[model samples]
Target: MRNHTSVTSFILLGLTDVPQLQILIFIFLLITYMLSVTRNLSIVILTLVDFHLKTAMYFFLQNFSYLEISFTSACIPRLLYSISTGDRTITYNACICQLFFTYVFGITEFFLLAAMSFVQYVAICKPLHYMTIMNFRVCKRPIFCCWMTTLLIMLPPHSLGLDLEYCASNAIDHFVCDANPMLKISCSDTWLIDQMIIISAVISFLITLLCVVLSYMYIIRKILKLPSAQQRTRAFSTCSSHIIVDSITYGRCIFVYIKPSAKDEMGINKGVTVLTTCISPMLNPFIYTLRNKQVKQAFNDLVKRFKLLSKN
Candidate 1:
């Protein structure tokens, strides 16, 4: 078995080999990437500039928006370059860096979502104590811990990949430097790493999902107890957007990462990856804004201010 140190670069076999299809995919992904960045950045800016959005909820939303931007950026730019230039060769170190950052951002999103769910739980189930529970200090701690813990947890697995021997073929079958695809190319024994990945994925998903479910369960129970139907509707509406986003994010992630045979289905894996990495980030701003009257109003106010500045 050849040491990975000798393998300077690996070729990426992207989504399709057809030249025409590559161009089409390039255009489509370019548009998707741009829209994702724009929408996410808009949410961040809106949350920052709007006085009405200075609450803990919007603070969490802003962090989430920034996370989405970083997450998609890590995956899409390399993908775009591969598709547009038809040059899919990535150096060994570069691939490792890509994998590391991707997992870092991906895991960070999990914790961020959990934090957001907790914020929603407090807001709905304990409205009286929502502010006290999710004040600036309390809210900032989770975000800080989420990023720090993700960095620490992800480093070991990524370092393990760096230590792998790559005597086998250096062609990655997917568009991104996904864990399983990278492992498939390694000549070293990957059973331990594979098990580690599976265990980690399961644990992370279950723990965060349990938190979200518990939060939502309490939220639903509280909403059901409301005497007025209109009050119940109003309470439910506030969380509907978060629930939708969480469903899409977690559904795709679980299908791709948490399954026993996840690595065996490259086609479905790529499709699901695209949904989570590209499509979901773009959809988040629209879902949050459309469902939220306050965000919509803030967005409109920002647009008018922009127009006034342009006229001047």
Candidate 2:
């Protein structure tokens, strides 16, 4: 791959060119990145230590939190460093690594969210069989499949990316090493790989989205059929957090990647990418924990345990 390309390093243009604006962007990204990592890490720790959280729902939540941490960490820290140091140049290998990890984690998240939707469906629509249906062994299988399937979907395009020749330019137009921006700067015939990326992204997006939609359809139907209003509300409440997260997750990605003319919309993509990579991750923990009674109780218990340990 290195031998084929004349460019040894690519300069990331970053979010802005103005030095003063860069400072503001850097501070914003820094604060959000710190908060995102801390909140997501707390979720991971809470799920692991809390006995009450030992269920299939929380198992998926733990993995989702991990993905949030990883997806944001991949993009934001690098941009923050570039903003702080005035060094926007990233090595060829480093750029590829960033692109690879970001997609792998981000795409796996779509599948995981779909799996979470199915878990919700079973818990609501099949209350008697919920535990038996989503047992520990059953829970682990979807998570594993999500990772493996994402790899299978991502590897071919990424492998083809290695053969791309970049003699024309070395400056990627976005803040991160995204595929579209990288393709725009390459000298190779990117039409085939570009189409492939779009096809894979659409296929992934639609299939997972269909799973979520279908699961929610069944859940809503079950809730509507409940005898009491209180029973319906209680059942619906359990799904609210997942629904909100799913909306934001899918909405952002669809705006960026699922459009017919995404490549030509670089200006809009940058802003959406910021929201996707930084703002969304920071908000997700609050969305789940604040809305979720079980998670909140687990968090409180964990905090109490810490205080008791400190006093001793």
Candidate 3:
């Protein structure tokens, strides 16, 4: 048992062992971080400034973009710093902070995506009562509720950390501070902590997954019944977007949280966490551009504004 002063820091093993290769990967991720920040910030600004984009879809999209920006910023900058300097160690408290916010945003995202799916379901399936029910307040309420719920869930992870004693290794296996990897170092029985995490995982997955499935089921049924070819095409178009977003978020998340018995498989799960944390932020802008018309117009308008401003 080594001297333990609160497991004050951690070491990260990122990318390649070769210095040259690590530098190259760092540059690539640096470019990605730039694009993620620029694209997501652009969406946030456009959603706020564009009068035509005041609809419920764009409103929620703005929130999504903002959250993605926060999530990526938290994860990527640290990873980039590690890559450049080869100093992957993060302070123990800092590691906990990272773990806390990562899950908070992640779980919030889980619920938010379901909420957005529900919004689309209402718009497509119950077109008659869409405006009446999905009023500004109703939509905004869930956004607040999901984040508030996320904060509450974050407390348990922090509490679990407080209970653990780090008598052995302090080096985290992966690039960032994650719950399961962090728990792997604990010199204490993790029965309570592991059980709490398991329960949280099951509850979040079942509730959010069910809501998305039901929403889309109704969405598909409504699309099939539409009389005109154009309406049916448009409805299918929208449904496809929701389905795509759902697949990306839920798939990576399910893989990350759902425990496997093998250590090798667990390593694989940790590796793919980069997908959830780093890659997903990049996709949000593309999702909006590909699926939502208002975002396209907003992007075009923003480009024109910048060009005109440059001429001045």
Candidate 4:
């Protein structure tokens, strides 16, 4: 790690400079951050405690929930703090740490989503063998691999970023310590690292998305082959939640990160990033739970248990 001797800390040019807008942004972020953490944590807790949700699908969901909580927490709280207080100066070490965790958790989610899609495919396309294929022991392997794969992909570029010399400007555009903005301000030759970052992102996106698409193709085909309309509907219904979540997860990321000149639209990108990190996490629990009967039933049972304990 090259010592960033000249620049001890970077000034994060948060969302806006206007005090009134800042107040509103702070309040909005505060509510969303709290709700995102709570709802995602609720999913994690429900999956752990609810017997009805003990399947492989819920296992992947529980991991996804944990990822949602972690990914949002990695960036949102820091932004909230920056908005609330006037403290936008993040230290060199702190900024690097933030960037690392943000990328790790965020990238890991793509792999996990692909894993979830595979679980869905097995459940739908190979119902007879679903349990044997996706049992608890078998399920843990993919989840472990997801994290390991993400780390392997992310570490090289992230480490290369640390050696970036910043003698000139430390005022990072937009909120978090994102790679693009940090790269914009760095005084080093960033071509190689930039390509590496883009390649890593593209590789992650394409590989995971291919898994999702192929899984869904088989799933759809299998669903169509069911003789009765009711059976097809039921099968599709089981996958509806995953499909919606996948669309949102992949769509937003593609819009924000896939482009060559991501730094060009820093302003628009920040807004999308807020939506990605804040609103999406808060909304996902609702998206997954509201459309599914099993999760709702599990939640109601959990609520009743809490109520009975309070009375006791």
Residue-level lDDT of model 3, residues 1-312, one tens digit each, is 556656778887655589888877788778878888888898899989888877787778889988888888878899988887778888877887888788887788888988899889888988899889888888799999888877776677568668788876887778778877778888788888888887787767778899999988888888888899999998888767668878988887667556565667557765577677667788767876787786788779988999999999
TM-score of each: 0.95, 0.96, 0.93, 0.95
Worst 10 residues of 1 by lDDT: 255-264
Q: Could you arrange the candidates by TM-score from highest to lowest?
A: 2, 4, 1, 3
Residue runs of model 1 more than 4 Å from their true location after superposition: 1-5, 257-264
lDDT of model 2 at position 103: 94
**Which residue runs does candidate 4 get wrong by more than 4 Å?**
1-5, 257-264
Please list the C-alpha lDDT of all candidates, in the order they appear. Answer: 0.86, 0.91, 0.81, 0.90
Cα distance off (Å), candidate 2, residue 95: 0.1
User: Which stretches of model 2 miss by more than 4 angstroms?
Assistant: 1-5, 257-264
Ranking by lDDT: 2, 4, 1, 3
- Candidate 4 lDDT by residue in tens digits, 18-96: 9999999989999999999999999999999999899999999999999999999999888888877799999999999
Candidate 1 clashing pairs, residues 3+ apart or interchain: none
Best by lDDT: 2
Q: What TM-score should be assigned to candidate 4?
A: 0.95
